[model samples]
Target: MFKLGLLIILAAIVVCAQSIPFLEESNTVAECLASNNITQAEFQELIERSSEEDDLENTERRYKCFVHCLAKKGNLLDSNGYLDVEKIDQIEPLTEDLREVLYDCKKMHDDEQYLCEYAFKMVTCLTDNLEQSDEVTEAEKNTNKLNE
Candidate 1:
């Protein structure tokens, strides 16, 4: 949950979304990865380096692709733009509404149009679409704060 939240926060840096508090409050890549007992500072450095040369749009796309690559390889997310709830359940079971949003976001996301903007864009949509009763997850709450 927090990993994906961190992804959106990191993505805001490439896109420079100032209105959102996510960027300000999120854990650094180094800190966030520690929670999972993973160590890969080089990955964050690589992503930062990739952002240095491109325009915002292209850089955003690169970041999305970078995230997509990680999620795909790690099996944390599916190509349909849904979080792998089963895999997440292996760690801990999530609420039903969180599951609904995951599937709904999967159906709503368009990889062709967004080109793998699932971490940020899809989560944003999911949070916005879910009502208060849906019991949005922590990641969804963070993502919902994204403006436009």
Candidate 2:
């Protein structure tokens, strides 16, 4: 069941990614740019003007590297090339749904682990789930107000 659920959600993320390709670009790209003494915004400017396919591919690779940079820097990635769930729990207040999302996202991994893709996918999944939780919390508050 969990595998099926993760597959569905990952498919959805990929579909959305097709429409906005840059949404697939993880923070790792930004981290990689720092080596060139470039800021995230500067990298964005550079990528935006690039028209060559090789350039895009190169940038994608850089983005992947950036993701690794972020995970390593934040201690988010474990030695196994997977997310350190313990570190995440220590750093963030995640609800049950968010934890589930994280678990599901984490299940999609390669031998190399592609921590950049994992981190970005996990980050986006968590952000979406957390926003839903916030909405539900706000709705509950409104309901309580009405009852009172």
Candidate 3:
């Protein structure tokens, strides 16, 4: 309920239709990390440092990669390696949508056709591979047997 609403808001914020507020609002690495969610602070700091370089295009490219890496790692609701089941539940919908946004950002940043194609393939592979992991397979088999 409340969690679902929070996820909807987060998805709206992350979508291509919406801008990344962290880039627009934050002035420092700390600020950016705080704004995006402290769970991603380390990666945000890395992006901030990369942006200090003179090349704006390079900065954007790196930032896109940073976002992709964050998404690949998982949702932002948990912190300090402790899973807050409540927070995790709250952000599940947003995390799912973030995966899509990260994939798109990776595609846009990948100038070389090879990297773009590779990333697209990687997206498919990660999603399918994750779904077929042992735990998920066992759960699915249990469900199928139950239904039968």
Candidate lDDT scores, in order, read 0.48, 0.51, 0.37
* TM-score per candidate: 0.41, 0.52, 0.22
lDDT by residue (tens digit), candidate 3, 16-131: 12234433454433343344444354453543554344332222333333233333233332233211233433444335544554445444433434332333333333333433
Which candidate's lDDT is highest?
2
Clash count for each candidate, listed in order shown: 0, 2, 0
Give the winner by TM-score: 2
Clashing pairs in 2: 28-66, 28-67
Residue-wise lDDT of candidate 1 within 1-41, one digit each (tens)?
22433444444432222213432454443443454344465
lDDT value for candidate 2? 0.51
TM match of model 1 to true structure: 0.41
Which of the two candidates, 1 or 3, achieves a greater TM-score against the reference? 1
Q: Model 3, which residues run further than 4 Å from truth?
A: 1-113, 134-148
Sorted by lDDT (best first), the order is: 2, 1, 3
Which is the better candidate, 2 or 3, if ranked by lDDT?
2
